[model samples]
Target: MGSCIICGTDVEGDGRICRSHQEDVVFDFRGNSPDQLVANRFYRGVVDGYADFGVFVDLAPGVTGLLHRSELDVRLESLEWEPGDDVFVQVTGVRDNGNIDLAWSIRQADREFRGELVHDGDSEWLPTDQADETEATDTAVETEPVEATSETEQTETAPTETEPTETADEPEPTETASEPETTETASEPETESAVEAAAEPADSVTASDERVTVASLGDRVDETVRLEGEVVSVRQTGGPTIFELRDETGVVDAAAFVEPGVRAYPDVVVGDAIRLDGEVERRRGDLQVETEALAVLAGDDADAVETRLAEALTAEARPEGLQPLAGDEAVAGLGEGLLDAAEAIRRAVLESRPIVVRHPATADGYVAGAALERAVLPLIDDAHEQSDAAYHYFTRRPTDEPVYGMDAATNDATRMLQDRDRHDEKLPLFVLVGIGSTTESADGLDLLSVYDVEAVVVDAAVADAETRAQVDTLVSPTLESVDADLSTGALVSSLASAVNDAVRSDLVHLPAVSYWAETPDRYVTLARDAGYDRERIAELREAVALEAYYQSYQDKRELIDDLLFDDGGDLAAHVSAQFREKLETERETASANLVTESVDGVEFAVLDTDAYTHRYDFPPTPLLLDDLHRHHANGDAAATVGIGTDELYVRSTGDLSVRSVASRTAEIAPEADVSTAGRREGKISFLAGERDAVEDAVVAAIADAF
Candidate 1:
């Protein structure tokens, strides 16, 4: 029996937590076999890898479990767990074949649990002070008797080894005779030479004016090298102060130590140009400079280093040309804007600045963001020596709304500011894909602009002058002479290729996957040539759309990659099947409930969404309306409207501004307070009390507008 770590109640079967407190205390499994796992007990584990069906977690070395997707509280793709991420899960069962099944725990962090214990095979152990005390006591007991016995033996053996009468006298006489000669011959001259050898190198290195680039450090390991560069980042670790130094060719970490956990060169900070003298040595298979002497470079020296870095970064960042994939004329017409956006992104990567991508939570937006991600990630890996550089340098954040609103802006601002203060990271460049080209995103853009953060908008939306003026770089075909119908995915796929042309083959099929209907002939050919058939393309699109709907605000990077690029195609097929089943059911329900009316010469199909459909489920209001409109319109001028308890959506076959309709409806039903409030697909909100009145007025308003 053992006492509970939290409540001090006695536990059974050598467990540290009582049955009542098991749920409150998280256990750290130390056992090597699955049989030691207790069902319904939460244990800390590391994410090993992901499978199509589940995530594999390693609770201990050789003890792994499957956390199936069905057991997850959220969608499998929505989980942000990467390989080696620490996660908490409950052991559901240990099968006869040595397979362990696990379930998700809502309490993921260490602080959320009341207490923690280490569970060994037969017993549970306290984690900290009590465990340490037990270990110390056992070590002391085993060593104390041996230490005393050895001391006693030494004392008894000393006299026997030396006969004091003869040996002690003989040794003293010889020592007196040879001491003077030995000291004269061996002590003074050698001491002075050794002292000079050490002092000379220290003085020479401190005063040396020679400088070497960061790229050349690998060749000069174990040798003193002087580096002149700007400090890009600074981190004070428990042992040494690490400064990321960047020169013309590359970046390297230089560690300066005053003492253990002490800050060295406290006055030096990020962006300060300095001359560092250190010995290049390998730590954990990476080259690091053990800083010996550091001094801030001044005047001409600092300016020269800064200038070299700037020129090198600029030259490396700018692409030579913007070649359209498949020679599409529309993409070529917007080449200048795409070129500028690409240059900014590449420059940010080279400067060690982070890139934050903000896109809508939709299939088209995801494809656009994923395309840029597929291109930029490889460039990041090639540019930085750090293994985890991709995580730090790039991030994709999906917004719940179609525009970059204040909520997303605030979250971004708070996160960036915290990173800057805590980790000394550079401010990230904001890349807005499929989301930032409208007036709705202006306030978010303005918030970012106040900090002088650069924002690049790559969208197919028609940008007004205000939206164009707010962003640093805008890539929109509508701004140019090209009037071709381009999906945001198609537009961004070209921009992604410009960012990194080496990944051109990977982006070939992305444009087709983004289009819901009317895919361009060239893109279809491009995708087919890339080995993705029409059926395969549809499966990929449906898979992404379903995943995007469930966790609309999360960037499901790994899962999306599998669906879009994996050759197995099983995951896509499975997910697409779910998409079809759910969509068909909703379509059937919506069609049966829909009511058609003729206002003047216009036709309208309206559904009472609140009463007839699953309002909170998949195929959201906007998506459902789009499908309904397409089926009813049949290439004719018709509109589908979904009227909910408080909100409504409008989808049309011809030109109509929901904004203009909302204005007219406000005049007809002044008490309803009608206003546009949702996605790019038109949505309006009104008081619940005036549902009938608002519906009648909106019908009249639509008839007048049509």
Candidate 2:
């Protein structure tokens, strides 16, 4: 009913593609049935393994077919193929014995396909041909070699007549019999397709007699054991298929190989509860089960496993209470909600689901995301037995804008889809720390919603009304009507503490480090008690702010971690010195260029932004204006405006909305061509010729509105 996301083709089922482009598109093949692959279609395949007979190409997980040597146009050894190299192929046929036949394709590169690749959850480009191929059953008619020789005997009997040479005719049958090993070697590939075909989706089945827990697998080395649980992940090596199977007790890897690079059990997928029988054994140093059989369990037996996991998880996942570091009651009340949110993240780690922390590319955003990362990573390591679990489980990404825009959403979608398709990995829990609020992020959230990706928002910005419906959890002071100037870092630091109470001491200085100026009294008290002096807090703040401005979009992970957490204060001191130098120089120059005027008892300090300030430099106009407003407050009568030809940025000691000023200008100087639209970043626009009138009206409006 809908159009394809790519190619805009009118599609029938699932809005995927039309019949023509389907053959051209590459898919993350979920091996369901051999019939799902259309007849005589080309596919993109990964080189699985090679044998003296031929090469094996993996079309999808648990689904591999063979390319016999005769099917190649050139010698197999001369093809220059390595394991895992992606190549193009054509399905020649599917054997009734449950095997696939592949032919060497002339167009071997992915770029040869004109259609877009439909990658992700399961359809692999497998072509289904008729079960039987063209049979030339005319049967090579041959005369008995003895009869031809007997004709020579008859000629001998004739005594004088000459007979044709029967010797040449006698060798013809031998040549036909020894023509090539092609036909004999063709059936040898069925050895790699040894597993039984799985045709129907099974519902819950009775446990096999050999069933045992994964924890007991190590004890049963060399013994046949049947284990049942969900398929946590599936990975195909050049040699064997490694399936990470997790039962309630623990997780163990089961290695299955019909042949090198061939999918062992084509029907099993991630998230499918399965019962498998394998021989327990050790390879290298780790224990792995040599799988003999695996079946995808369905129905109530599958539901039973999931329900048990859910019940066990839900019990341990919920937090006991709220813990507030801040003394304010409003913050304390919100702390309870933060605890619940923290538990969600902690549970994701325990459940082996990935966590993605998205924050704005500012000092506050970085500190917030880094704080959560610092807290959650250790938990991931403790929860999973693998050393790489921490890296795989936790990710902290810095977004350019403070809103969840389409770009960020698209990036997350693309990565998650690939993981799900290739590795059988689960979707990530999006922990939107500072960058997800307001109606501007609705479209971005809608995209994630399509795949059911969950999000957690912790911010201190004024939230849009629609933002609540978009997120699973929204933690913001403004949303609760708590008029506190807490930064996002400060709020998330509290949540991070609730995530791991042991990391509380490590984050003592983070809240204070998030504030650029006028550090909150509560945070200052906490930082002082944690042994960080006023000078150290300022150094951390300025250092991070300087770093935040330079690469703005990058995570700057290890460097930021060392800056904020290193016991030695050298990094912070060095960076903070340069930070203060640049900011102070810009401030002094901006002050020198300031033009002062007052209208109706209101003061206005207007600076030509393009000339006075280094617009491209550190301390962006907003930060610069904040410094200017604080530094030039001689009884604070009105506001300071940084005027550019295209726009003006305003900062006032009193309550200010530039919209009010633009509205007044429209009435007074309607011919001035002044407008207030597209000014969300606290800036307004006006005509260059109407400067005097716009300024006059702005001053008058500020005087009247405030």
Best by lDDT: 1
Candidate 2 residues 1-706, lDDT tens each?
A: 6454334667764445566455544443455566555546676678999998889988887678898887775667667889998777788778787588988775453322333333333332212111122231121122222211110011001011112346421122210111122343334323322333112122222325756887676688878777888788876542346677877655677766543234557667788888777677764344677665677777997897788667756765666665665654555667756876887896787567889999877778889998998889887765544444666678888875646889889999998997787466889999997767766678899999999888988877666668888888888766347555677888888888888888888998788888867778888898999889899988888888888888676666667888888648998999999988998999999988888877777778888888888888888776788678788634454788877766677777665666677778678877678765322245667788887777677767777876
Write down the lDDT of every candidate, Cα atoms only.
0.77, 0.68
lDDT per residue for candidate 1 within 1-706, as digits (tens), equals 6776555678776766677666766777888899988999899999999999999999999999999998885678777889998889999999999999999886665433545666877787645323244334334212112211210011100001112355532211111110122322333243233222222222245434677877777788888888888888886542346788888777787766432223557778899988877788775456778776677877998899889989998899999989887777888888999999999999988888899999887889889999999999998877665555677789999876877889999999998997787578899999999887878788888899999999999887677678899989998866446444688898899989999999999999999999888889999999999899999999999889899988777788777877877648899999999999999999999889888888998888889999888988988877778887877543454788899999898887777888888999999999998887753668888999999999999889999987
Give the TM-score of each candidate: 0.74, 0.66
Number of colliding residue pairs in each model: 0, 9
Runs in model 2 deviating more than 4 A are 1-186, 189-193, 197-227, 246-254, 277-292, 326-328, 421-424, 478-480, 632-637, 643-648, 657-701
In model 2, what are the clashing residue pairs, if there are any? 29-123, 29-124, 30-122, 37-128, 38-128, 62-263, 203-298, 203-299, 204-298
* Cand. 1 Cα-lDDT: 0.77
